[model samples]
Target: MEQFPILLGAGIVLLFVFWFGFLSLKMKMPNVILYILLGIILAKWISHHEILHFASEIGIVILFFLLGLEFKLKRLGGIARKIWPAGLLDVFLNLGVVTFIGIWYGLDPFYAFLLGGVAYATSSSITAKLLGDTGRMANRESEFILGILIFEDLVAPIVVAIIIGLSTGEPMTLFDSGILVIKIFGITVAAIILGKTVFKKFDQFLNKIHDEDFKIALFIGIALSYGGLALWLGLSEVLGAFLAGMMLSDVERIERVEQTVHPIQNLVLPIFFVYFGTTIQFVNGVPMLPLLAILVFWSIAGKMLVGIIGGKLYGLSPRVSFRAGLSLCSRGEFSVIIASIATGVFKIFSGIYIVLLALIGMLLFTRAPQMTNKLFGKPVKKKKGLKVPGS
Candidate 1:
C-alpha cells in the first residue's frame, strides 16, 4: 500500500495513544508506561521521525510549565528551604554512590559519571502523572515527592552540560561551571522579576481580552520560548519552561489560563513517551547483565533511601516517608536524555535500565500506599466523644 499522508498518519498515532490512555484508566495503570511500550513496538516505523520529536518536546515543556503554574515565588522559597537536605541526600545516593559503583565495575570515570547521571533523576513526568492519577496529590507524602523532583530538575541540567563537555573532551573548568550557574541564576531572577512586575497585572488584561486563541498562543509562546532560551544557554529546556510558568503564576486567574493549555499538553505529552520508546535501539543483546543487575538494584534502593531519609528530614512520618520512597524509583526523561549520550554497549545498557526501572517504579507507585499499610498498618483513628473518665 502507498504510505499514508503525514496528517493521516499523525491522526492514527493519536488514536493509538488515546486507546492506550483509555486502557490505562480502565486498568488503573499509569499511561506513561503504556505509551512507552507503544513507542518501542512502533520504533521500527517511527524512529527518529522529526515531527514526533518536536511534538514530544512541546508536550514536556508545557507539562513543566503547568507544574510551575502551581508555585509562586514565595511558596517556592518555602519548599526549597524545607527540602534542601533531602535533595542533598538524593544527590549523594543516586549520583555519588552510583558513580562510585560504575568506577568500581571498571568503567572509566566519565562513563561512570554518565551511569550516575542516568540514575540520579526520578521520572518527573511519570511521578507527576501518577500523583494526579492516583489521587495522591493531596496525600501527605506528595509534597516531599514533588520537592525532590524539583531539586532533581534544577541539578540535572548542570549535570547534562558537564557530561556533554566531558564527552567532547573539553571538560568544563571551574570557571565554566560558574558561568553556567550564573546563567541559571540569571534566568531564575528574570522570571521572578517578570512575574512580580509584568504578569502581576496580567489578570486584568487577560479578562479584558476575549480571544481564547490569543490567550493560548501567549501561554505556549512563553513556555516554548523560555524552554528554547534554556537550550541556547546550554541548560535544560524543562528548567526554562518551568520558570516561564512560574513567571505567570502571579496572574490572578491562572487556573483559567491553565484550563486553556492543559488539553494541548495532554495531547502532545504522550508523544514524548512514545518517541522516547522509539529511540531505544537494542542492536545486540543486553550488554553486561551483571552490571545491569547491580545498577538496577541500586537505582531502586538509592531513590528509596533518598525518599525515606529525606522524608524524615522533611518532617514526614515514617510510614509516609516509606511511601514517598517507593513512589520514586522510576527514572524517566532525564535518564533518557543522559542515556542518549552513550553509544555501543552502554547505550543498550542504559536503554534497558530506563525501561525496566520505569515499569518497576510505576508498579511500586501504584502499590505504595498498600505496601506502606502492610508495614505500618493503617493509622488508627481516635473514637470521637468516647470519652473521658474526667468528663
Candidate 2:
C-alpha cells in the first residue's frame, strides 16, 4: 500500500516511454535508444528498486517467450544445421574476438567471458524490423541473415545460463558444471517429450476454449510458470520460457498466440529497457569512454566480418557477403539482458556497449542495401512473394 506513489510514477514513466517510442519510429530511430534515453532521464527521479526489478524481470521472460514463438522446431533444425559454419564464424568474430579484447584490457577472465557473450548475439527484433522497412526480406542475403539471427537466438540462452552460474559469489567446480549440464539437458528433453505427449492434449483443450481472452490468459500463465519452474531448477528461466514457447509452437497457431501476447510483451519489454537505463550511473571511477568506443567497434566489426564470411560460405558475392555481414550489426535485447543481470563494472560496460551498438547498427542498416547496390547493381533479386511471418 505504501508503494502506491511509486507505482503511479512508474505508470507515468511508461507513458513517456510509449510516446518516445512512437516519435522515434516516425524518425526511423531505434526505440531502444529512446528507452535508454528515457531511462537515463528517469535516473534522476529516484524510484524504488523492487517494483522496477519485478516488471523488468517479467518483461524479459515474456520477451524470450515471444521470441521462441517465432521459430518452430522443424524449421530451426533445418536452418541451424545448414548454417552451422556461418553460425560458428559468427561466434568467433563477435564473441571470441570481443572476449580476447576484454582480456587484453586487463579485465578478469570471468568479465571477459561476460563481454564475449555481450558481443556475440545480434538483435533479431531490430534486424527484422529494418528488413521490413527497407523491403529487403526476400533479398538474396536475407536467408543468411534469418539463419544467423535464429542461430544467435539459440546460442544466447546457453551463454547467459553459464555466465549466471559461474558469476555467482560461490566458486564453481566440476561438480557444479556437471550439475548445470544435466539440469539443462534433463529439463529440455523432458519438456519436449511432455509437450508432444501430455501437453499436446492440453493444448488441444486450450484450443477448444471458445473464450479468446481466457485462452490467452492461460497461455501466458503456462509460459511464465515454466519460466518460474526453471528458475527453481537452478537453470536460466529465459531458457525455460523459450522451451515453453517451443513446446506450444506446433500445437497452436503461432499467429494467434503472438497476436494475443504481443500487446502484453509490448507493455513489459520496454520496462526492462527503462529499468536498465535508470541503473546507469557512470561516475568518477568508471572508464566510461574508452570501453564504450572499443565495444562499439567490437560489436560492429565482429558481426560485419563474420557476416561477410558467413555470406561467402553460403555462396553469396563479395558485395552480398558484405551486406549480409553489415546487416547483422545491431545488438539489442540479449545484450541488454546480459547487462541487467550482471553487477558493477560488467553491468555498466554492457549498457554502454549496447546503446552504442544499437545506434551504429541502426545507421548501418540504412546503408546496407544502397551500399550493396553500389557494389553490385541490384543486390537483391526480384521479389517473388516471400512472406516472413511477423515481419
Candidate 3:
C-alpha cells in the first residue's frame, strides 16, 4: 500500500511533464525549464516527499549517462585546435569577470573563485538542443560552441577538485593543484585505454549473443561500472559517463545502445531539473519579487557581455556576436551542481540562493524564438554565415 502513493505521484509528475513539455515545444520555450518549474510546484505541494527525492536522484544519474552517450571524440578531435584556445579564453575571461563581481560584493575570495568557475561553464545539452532545433547544428559557429562546451566539461572537475581542497582547508597551493590535475589527466587517459579494450571485447560478445535485452543490459553494466569507479575515485559521475561513451563510440553496437537508452534517459532526466527547482529555498524569507528581478538582470547582462566580447574577438559581425553572446547566456545543470558543492564544502549558504535564483532566471529567459530573434534577427540569413571574430 505504501508503494501505491509513490506510484501515483510518479505518474502525476510524468503526466504534467509530458503536458508541459508538449506545450514548451509548441510555444518555443525550453522544455527542461518547464519540467523544472512543474517539479518545483509539486515539491512545494508535497514538501519534498521521499519518493519524489528518489525519483529525482535517479533522473540525475540517467541524465548524466545520456550526456556521456552524446560525446563524440572524433568530432571533438577534429576541432580541438580552434576550440581549445577559444574555450580556454572563454573560461578565464568569464571567471575573471564574475570573480571580480563576487569580490566586489564582499564575498570571500574562495567563494568568489567558486562563483567565477561555475559561471565559466556553458550547458552542453541546452546549447546542443537549441542549435539542433534551429537547424544551425551544422554551422561553423555551432561546431565551435560544441567544442568549447566539451572543453569546459573537461575543465570543470579539475576546478571542483581545487575548490574541494580549498574548502577543506587542506593545502590548495599551485603545486598541489597542479599535481592533482596531472593525476586526473592520468586517470582519464587510463580510463579511456581500459574502456576501449573492455568495451571492444564486450561488443563482440554482445553481437554473438544477438539478444537485444541482453545487449542493453551489458551496455548499462559498463556505464554504471565506470560511473561507480569514478565516484570511488572522488571524480564526478558525469566525467566517468563521458569517458565510457567515448570508449564505446567506435563500437558497432553504439547505435543500438543509444536507441535502447534514449527513452529511459528522456523520462528520467527531467526529474533532475525539477529537483533543482524545488530545492531553491529563499534566503532569510526574502520576498520572491525583488530577488527575482535582481537575478534576471544579472543573468542576462553577464552572459550578453561575455557573448559580445567572445564574438568580437573571433571577428564576428555585431549582430552575430551579440546573438552568440545572448545564446550562450543560459546556465543549466552545471551551475546547480556547483552550487550544491559550494553549500556542502564551503559552507556558503548565501551562494546557494544566489545561484538558484540565477539558474531559475536563466531558464525563464532562455526561450527559443525570443533568443533566436535576439541573436539571429528576422529571417536569419542562410548565405551570410557567422562572421568569425577578427575576420
C-alpha lDDT score of every prediction, in listed order: 0.91, 0.76, 0.63
- Report the lDDT of model 3 for residue 282: 42
For 250-336, candidate 1 gives per-residue lDDT tens digits of 788678989999989988999999998998876757788999999888889988998889999999988999999999999899999
Candidate 2 lDDT at 331 equals 81
lDDT of 3 by residue, 1-391 (tens): 3444766766787788789889988978667667666765665555465666766655555545655555555554666655555666677566677677778766788888877766667665556555654676665455545555667777877777777777788847888767767756765787667656766565676567766777657666666676667767766666666676667776664677788776666776676666656665544543334433444456566656655665556555566556566566666556656766666433334344444544554453354336656656675447767788999
Better of 1 and 2 by lDDT: 1
lDDT of candidate 3? 0.63
Better of 2 and 3 by TM-score: 2
Give the per-residue Cα lDDT of candidate 3 at 311: 56
Clash count of each predicted structure: 0, 0, 10
**Model 1 worst lDDT run, 10 consecutive residues:** 3-12
Candidate of highest TM-score: 1
In model 3, where do residues sit more than 4 Å from their true spots? 1-8, 25-28, 45-72, 128-136, 201-204, 283-323, 341-391
